[model samples]
Target: MITQLRVDDRLIHGQVALVWTKELNTPGIVVANDNAATNQMVQMTLKMATPTGKKLLIRSIDDAITVFNNPKASDMRLFVLTNSVTDALNIAKAVPNIEGINVANVGRFAENANESTQLSSTIMLTDSELDSLKELATLEVPVFSQVVPSNAQTPITALLKGIK
Candidate 1:
């Protein structure tokens, strides 16, 4: 069954391969990113990053959704990864059954202006990404930011509370 959906700029890396794998206990990992899916080097890197013996599938957003929905893909605990808030919103909208998204990391954006509040050293959200996150928060799905299971979850509501 599809379990956790994560929004992390670095999809499938050291922390995800080790920490999240152990935390979620999900053997199946699916990374849905257009750029990563099409890039052979990126795909190879993700495959190598996956924990030993766990299954990893990197596909475009649509195909990744199909993989999760397929009956043949059952029998596995799956964690879905996306690099952008927009992409996470799209996945959540396309597949209503997706549990929820964990906002792990958004990274700095070239377009980020002075208005963008730096949530962490790695995450800096621009207006567009923040707006998408706001919309996701309105959905029935839960939206919260936490780099790892150990860190306290910062709900989207709390972060957006004082912001215009």
Candidate 2:
């Protein structure tokens, strides 16, 4: 069901509605953020960002795991987006079947340079986050960083090495 799991701070935005959705052929967009789940205003903002006719679900990380684990999820091309590496790590720990995580726009709030690898205008990194990403990689989950459809991706490992 989940064709792609991405870590993007912006969640559903222009690049997501216009580019990644079409590139991945995703019919459903799932935003897994605890904060967004409880806030009606933020939820409405996220819903407005999505393209018309596409199914959008904004839920907490736990609910996302449940939905992703369900058999019905297999029928839809799902795109899961989280705002932080910690959230991504949490989901991966809860759902071991998820094989990969794509690192997209991490935004301007990220601190701790050692935890993540800076990729572009919308990307940043910190060491603990990078370590968590490595844990996912050890489980055979490939972590990739790409801004948009046309940008080149750099593996998290390579970025880590460059940081060191």
Candidate 3:
């Protein structure tokens, strides 16, 4: 089962490779991004970032969903990562055992930052991303933003309030 699906543009990094893996006690790390899955260099970097002794799997969104739904997957604790809100939404819709969806970091490096909405220090969402996030908020699973294990979980709904 997925302990959490984190939306981080950097995919795997110090905060994620070290803090989150230990915090969630998830030994299996899955990167569910289309770009990362097909890119050899990206996969290498993500693999290097993975904590030693923990397992890592890089798959496209659809392939990751297939892996998540496999009966054997229920026996393990997995932490999934996606680069965009849309990808996270797609996974959440197809998987039933996700504990939460963390909109940790996104749009920080987006070219259209000027047109995006600033939801938090780490989250800047483009118009299309915001639409996906609104839909994500309506899902049964908990959807929130918590940059690290130390930060409090801020519900996506709260951040969406008052925004046009």
Find the candidate with the highest TM-score and give its number. Answer: 3
lDDT of 1 by residue, 47-74 (tens): 8899998888889998887877788766
Clashes of each: 0, 7, 0
Local error of candidate 2 at 2, Å?
A: 1.2
- Give me the overall lDDT of model 3: 0.95
Per-model TM against the reference: 0.89, 0.86, 0.98
Per-residue lDDT tens digits for candidate 2, residues 11-52, read 888999988889988788999999999999999999999988
Candidates sorted on lDDT, descending: 3, 1, 2
List ranges where model 2 is wrong by over 4 Å: 96-99, 111-121, 162-164
**56-146, model 3: which lDDT tens digit per residue?**
9999999999999999999899999999999999999999999999999999999998889999999999988999999999999999999
Give me the candidate number with maximum lDDT.
3
Q: List the residue pairs that clash in candidate 3.
A: none
Ten-residue region with minimum lDDT total, candidate 2: 110-119
What residue runs in model 3 are displaced by over 4 Å at the alpha carbon? none
Among all windows of ten consecutive residues in candidate 3, which has the lowest summed lDDT?
18-27
